[model samples]
Target: MHQQDNGKAETFDVAVIGAGVVGCAIARTYALAGARVVMLEKAADILDGASKGNSAILHTGFDAPPGSVEAACVTAGYREYLEIREKLGLPVMRTGALVIAWTEEQEAILPDLIAQAHANGVTDVEMLSREDTLRREPGLAPSLRASFRVPGEFIIDPWSAPLAYLGQAMAHGAELRRSCKVLGGDFGGTHWDLKLSDGSVRAGLVINAAGLYGDDVDLALIGRRDFTVRPRKGQFVVFDKSAAALAGHILLPVPTKITKGIVVCPTAYGNLLVGPTAEDQTEKDVADLVPDTLAALRARGEEILPGLKDHDVTAIYAGLRPATEEKDYRIRHHADQNYVTVGGIRSTGLTSALGTASYVFGLTEQTGFHYDPPESVHWPTVRNISEAQQRDWERPGNGGVVCQCELVTRREIESALEGPLAARSLAGLKRRTRVTMGRCQGFHCTARLAEMTEGHFAVPMAEATGHD
Candidate 1:
């Protein structure tokens, strides 16, 4: 295993093997608990997995079955998210969620949904009449019979949430190693001897939170054969923030036996989102999404909410769900081997991140690694970057609107490029700063961003443009 520059083989209490939303949350939780925690991510930054792309709904877990792991974690995580968001002051549009029923059959499903939500202990749910639904969300298809008004399900800023967790963890003493890929590891005596593509770090315990590739990590580490994963691709489209008032809340269709279908939800950035058509594929290519699937999402959006077409689409994105055949999250702990496996965290991973972290940490504790709770852990209150960063940004070198479409100030891009976890490509920068993810879809910003990425990362212009 490669060692750090200091040559001191530092042993942490635990090492999280992915920096997705769930893994970051777990590392942050452990760091707050006074454990020497380290978060390892393959990409240049965190949230580069299923965490970056999703419906962004703070789900009520109304559809999950009672007594299920997903139900418990989601319920607990929702509450935890509320507290964290309050403390962090991150953006959250609590517009609520409405599962609309257009047909009579779909309308009949609302009662069962209400029953299921109640079974999961999700109270404060209301069954709204068609009239009330129309009044609340006049942009609906108008033929709706009723809707399940799930007040707890709201929309939040997916990008900033995990970043905030990581920022706090970093300030509170968690080491985040970006661009460090864990190739494989073995259970070394008293610790796990971690193997990495770039470098390595040893910890008392290893956590497999690698998102879509989580099972692969598990199989590579322990050769476990209990489960398999298939990446289910979902496509979403964003509308301008001015169109946010086109609907008052998240408009969801009656979920079928297959998936929740596409949804029209408002995002924390004030933009409106419509999408997520689920399609199963055996590949784990997170970057490439089939354009045909995205087209289907646009078609469905037009059908669900007629007013969705009234405005221009800001951007289009695709995310792969870490689908497991079991259709449930696979979280396991091996006390003897000092490993924790977190897999099949699909559509609900974003909402259940905090609770999942708490649960996973408890499993790590079962392995008997001693952890001392911190004496007043003070996380950085970072609503924005420093004044110096702002000043440095107004200069050149990818300055003056690297991504013009998103209004990403040159300062923001410079800060991202030179921050603790600097991005190396347009895609990496997009994940960090939301550049080129707005209206015009990088048409105006591509040239400038590509040039800057080429200059900084030393990649060919064609390569940068090709990737983005």
Candidate 2:
């Protein structure tokens, strides 16, 4: 492991701040292209912020504004994620999507959406009448006036995507430091010197993919404030797996300019999701769940899918998006400063992650950074062990099942405990193995899980409850 635990100063060819999906993709791509890289995160683990929350939908750019960065990145990233999902053996549910209009006002927007879809390079969208829409999604409101079928959209395992990128990056010699916040930085003409919470690092090139804190990091690096990340709080509700059958495909509402609107979709893990009430806030670091917001989401969900609110609510959570004043992403390259800032990557960031990485790499090249492919490098996969691949050390030999709700076995927990970027917190283990992420939501499993990580995190059982 190249992780610097002693908080000593270091140097690298490339340094990426933030370990969200986009940051991981940037670091991983740089490493794959043979640049020494390091990924820094303020949180205890990657994918711990908005990257893991929000609607985990892989958009096809069907409704993105024409000629926008989001449109291009989403259109390209959706395709790339599909290919990479298969290559990494990650879980992805290609449930397609239905953008339905239930009111006359909303019905009037279908043509424009279709036009936007075509403009964004997505030609697979099809228009459907009320009858056809109901036939496709019987649970949807019978008042549906029309629908647009986007066949390319999918529901992906959000947790594993970042892990795959970071895993490959680490295997290719990139280092990852958790809980390492960038306090400040200075451009030294030849290189950039960054002061971390524990130590410092000197890098030839710096890329800021910091999610909610991008604005703060940008100020530290460039000493200018071109944009501010408005924390848009979005709350969601998850229904038990039993409700998954109610929605065949991801059911979306006709989006408006301000938000994508609440959606009801089936997750890759077999649970139905309804949510994401978009409410922009003045606070930049918001993570609280407003009970009223969740209630309103349920009410809206009932209208989208008849009887949807009746389903047993499994969990409810909120995520803060990094929205900015500009409608487009705040990606810029400073050749003189040897820096790139990737900011304002709001809701579509998950779908646009890989494509954004490619774009950022191009920006880096413009700053005189060169990339050359290595002969061979290791790539890690978190594909759950199949019955056929299970080893004695992975199963009954290690211990017994720890989290039965998610079917997370003892071997999985052990693997997380001992793996690279080892699980040092309950949240870390949850992101890695999906433990404590079921209907019970750790009520039945936290005790055992805490014991397993006691030595690793040195925390008590009560304090080991998973963090948001």
Q: Which ranges in model 1 have alpha carbons more than 4 Å from their true place?
A: 1-10, 286-288, 382-404, 447-462
Model 2 lDDT on a 0 to 1 scale: 0.82
Residue-level lDDT tens digits of model 2 in 1-468:
123424766778899999999999899889999998988888877787768786888888888888877777877788788777656666667689999888898999899889988888889899999999889888888877999999988887777787888888888889888889999998888777899997888788899999888888888878887788888888899888888889989998899878898899998777888878888888866678888878888888888877776788888888889889987888888878898889999899988998999888887776578967789867577754321123334545657777877777787788788866787677777877778788888989887877777777634556654465
Residue pairs with colliding backbones in model 2 are none
Q: How many steric overlaps does candidate 2 have?
A: 0
Clashing pairs in 1: none
Clash count, one per candidate: 0, 0
Encode model 1's per-residue lDDT on 1-468: one tens digit a residue: 223436745567788998888887888888888777888888755676777788788887889867878877888788898886757646566788888888888887788888888898877889899898888877777777888788878877676677778777877778877778888887866788788876667788788889888888988888874568888888888887777878878888888766888888877656888878888888886546567766777767767778877877777778888888876788988777888888888888888989898888777666666577767867554333211123223546644655554557676776677755567666667766777677777778777766556665635556544544
Alpha carbon deviation, residue 121, candidate 1 (Å): 2.0
